[model samples]
Target: MKRVALVGMPNTGKSTLFNRLTGGTARVANWPGLTVELASSRILLGANMVQVFDLPGIYDLTGGAEDEQVAQRFLSEAKLDAVLLILNACQLERQLALALQLKALGAPLLIALNMVDEAKRAGITVDVAALSEALNAPVQLISAKYGQGMAECKALLTGIFSNESHQIDFSNIPSASTLHQTEKQLFQRSVHQPPILNQSATDKLDRFVLHPWLGFPLFVLMMLALFQLTYTLGTPLQDYLEAGLTWFKDGLLVPATANLPQFWQGLIVSGLFDGVTTVLTFAPIIFLFFCLMAVIEDSGYFARAAFMMDGLMSRLGLDGRGFVMLMMGFGCNVPAIMGTRVIRDHKARLLTMLTIPFSLCSARLQIFLFLSGALFSPTQAPWVVLSLYLASILIAMLTALLFKSKFKSSEPFALELPPYRLPLLSHIWRRGWGEARDFLRLATTMIVLGVVLVWLLTNYPTQQHSYAELISNLLAPVLSPIGIESTLSIALIFGFVAKEVVLGALSVITGHEGQALATQLAHTLDPVSAYSFMLFSLIYIPCVSAIAAIKKESKSNLYTAFSMAWSLGLAWMVSFIFYQSARLFGF
Candidate 1:
């Protein structure tokens, strides 16, 4: 088997080309740094088995940026058969510098001019033969997104590896001045621009979308609509899944366990089955949320959002790149924290990692949607969810503001906005399906353990004054101030494992699931207290997975401990204020 790595500048369609060659999703996001880690897959090229690696995008091989360093170390150290250097045809001049550096290394190089379709549309053309002859390397003009010229590209790959003779010479690396002059020469020889270059549709759209007066407001409106649409459309599909899961449990599993002892029956049916299924019920909503996000990202508007937020982000000690990482947190904070590698400044990266856990991730979103819909009316539920999202942004912003002085970043920020294109259906499906699978995996593992633990604590040593009640009694004094009672406190305690477990914990504790559990919760707490609990849940500590990610990324136990402590303290203070203030208003 031969190993080949895909290398390119940011947003040059490397992941798309990797997917085309290997039939893998490879996380095709339009925003930079979304592919923070190496993505690899194996496929057969003719009779030869080939391994393709999609590396993080880097601007310069010698650059100090985290992604750049990652790509640099891999290229300099890894044993490889060929290097597939992908360049955006429309931005050939700016990208040629990296190619020149690679060529200087004497690595086995194959230059691929990606996005030729978009280039042609923009009245740009690349002279492929001229470029190949100038570099003395195999160059293929291909559109990875549309599968144009993919056959020829694969044939070219076979030819490169057929020789089985390649060497990398690190000693011959080119200086910046030499690389720049050579890049200019290469561009002049092989690339041509129209005499009168016209502004693209992306520019016209940016006039409104990126407007100084309208950009921020448009972002807010888009967010509001995103949640509303997710809830309105996803709720029905979730209900259907919930019904199917319920039927599977009640109609099949229940009868199957009929002959079991009472204790075993309760554990299997009420504790494990109900717990996992309750979490599974919200998979549709979470999947739809990821799909909507995928559409925004793949269409290139997410990068524009980062660009628009650059001013406000700088005020909070970050820049546009930090903003992108924060938005990535909405899908999952673990990866978002890992994605902070894109922020070159150490302080800014740490600050962004600390702020990301506050994001309203899909796990927490499931809990919010369930509780809000149970307590609030249908029309009011979406507002409740949207308000939580706004609160998330507020808390993250406030976190950055408070820590800005300690972790100040002087690194300048600049982001390139990719041209907007209609999102590919296959990419959207891959992202959504991947998220849904992750949620189910979480459900079957952590959520199941949490539910069983809750059941044991609530049921063991007698139902009345059980172990759970004893634990909650100890916590009642501290929680009472924030309208959190004993049973709810127990759920919060178990939620430290995973937010998805909170509902499962509720189901086990109250001996109910689905609507029954929601009804039970509705009766247990008033509207203000319910909202207060939601606030606490939203702002409290991140899941255990996220904590591990923070520790590994920051490589500082002290920093990780501080992140945990700060979020815990902030959650209490914020929830207390809301609960007490709402009561004062006579609500």
Candidate 2:
């Protein structure tokens, strides 16, 4: 298949165009540097299937940033039949400089004047024919978001394969500053625009949302509301799903397998069904969390939050984009770790990856929500959950500070805030389903394995001197200081597979579900120990998937081992302090 690469400056809607062309959810955020890795998908154009690669956004091909290097390497390494140089019409003069740079790369180029609708709305008009003549390239006006001019763009791309590739002389290519000045002259010659004093709705809203004093407070409030909605609206749905799963197990699976061997029946019903059902019950919360995050992300508020938080992040030798990736961590650590690619700095990216494990991901949050409702008062539940989230943020910040002196800082941080638009329901659904689907895919395999292992440990050997007991006894001396006993320690062990499995593991051990399980937990754990356990869970080594992501991103076993050792040590120390301090106070 022929290859076509989508190349453009950051925040020019290039990813959105890629999604439209390839029908893949490559994570379209209204912020710069979201596409840190190369994303490729094949699409049938006319009679031929062509592979379209979405390269990481870069300001200059000649620059030395990580993303720029990736793009340059991809162009040099990959077989490319054509390059689609997308540009933001609203920022034509600035975007054109990158386009000019790409033109000098001597590849067959097509200019996609994206965001033409936004430019028009801003009272700017571009003379496409004149601009095309000047650039000596085919300029296609497109709005990737609304699906306008896509067919024409694809048709043009299809025709490119038949034509000879365009080649330009690199020797005559102008310098960056010279190209910028030339782009300005070209823009002035071919485009007419209104005066710069006019304020759009985005500017008006940013007056408050971006205000130094008000922005951070509003960001906190928005995040609080997100959690509040996740609980309030998701609880009933979660209950319904849990009940449905239980009914399926008792109503269908039990009777269907009644004649099977007793051991087989126990493995099928008590082990697999219960464990899988328990994790699935939390799907509602995960879905809800993603939906809310998608809304915040699509509405462009996430970028503003990053901009607002840049000062605090810079103090820790990070930047606003790292903080944005941290916020993404609250939904899931896997993607958040992947999202760290947006951080152009190698040290900052690694630091951000290290901090994400402390972000109270949805799986950990699910466990906390379950425990909070089961053990604490109604009014206290919200506060308990909120406190854990706050603790996660505090620990992540502290972790950054602790390591700030060790790593040198990278490039200066700059973020472009896209205009806020109402999030489409389809976009929200796509993002929500995407995350939920990924969670299920990971959870199904890991949870089942974890459950089967725990079940084998507890059920085999006639339940006397069970493996859980043996392991707990072995670790008791070490765990006792943190107020964690055998049962809890065993659950924590399985939690390494996935955090959601911890609750299910406990339920399996006690032969209880729902309220019965809650009652059993209450008898086993005091408030202080419970809180200490929560704290430990919040800071412990990440799940297997997260560890793999860290290793893949950092490409260092030592760093990955360090992450585990540090988190485990931190968890133990923090939990021990909490437990011992509370006991000393006679709580």
lDDT of 2 by residue, 1-587 (tens): 78798999988888889989989988876777777788989988888878899998878767666677788778777767889989888888677787777666667778999988888888888898998888877889999989899988988877777444333344554567878778888889988888773888999999999998999778778877887888899889988887887788789989999999999998888888776777777788888888988899889898888898899989987888888888778877887897776666788888888889999988898789888877888677878888898899889989999998886676798888888877778778888888789778967787788878888888868788787788879998988999887567878998998897897787778777666677888888888888988999999999998999999989999999999999999999999999999999998
lDDT of candidate 1 over 396-488, digit per residue (tens): 989999999999889999888999988888889999999999888988788888999988898888889799989988988888889988678
TM-score of each: 0.97, 0.94
**What is the lDDT of every predicted structure here?**
0.88, 0.83
Score candidate 2 by TM-score against the native. 0.94
Once fitted onto the true fold, the runs of candidate 1 whose alpha carbons sit more than 4 angstroms away are: 162-167
Instruction: Give the lDDT of residue 400 in candidate 1.
Output: 97
Worst 10 residues of 2 by lDDT: 162-171
Backbone atom clashes (below 3 Å) for every candidate: 0, 0
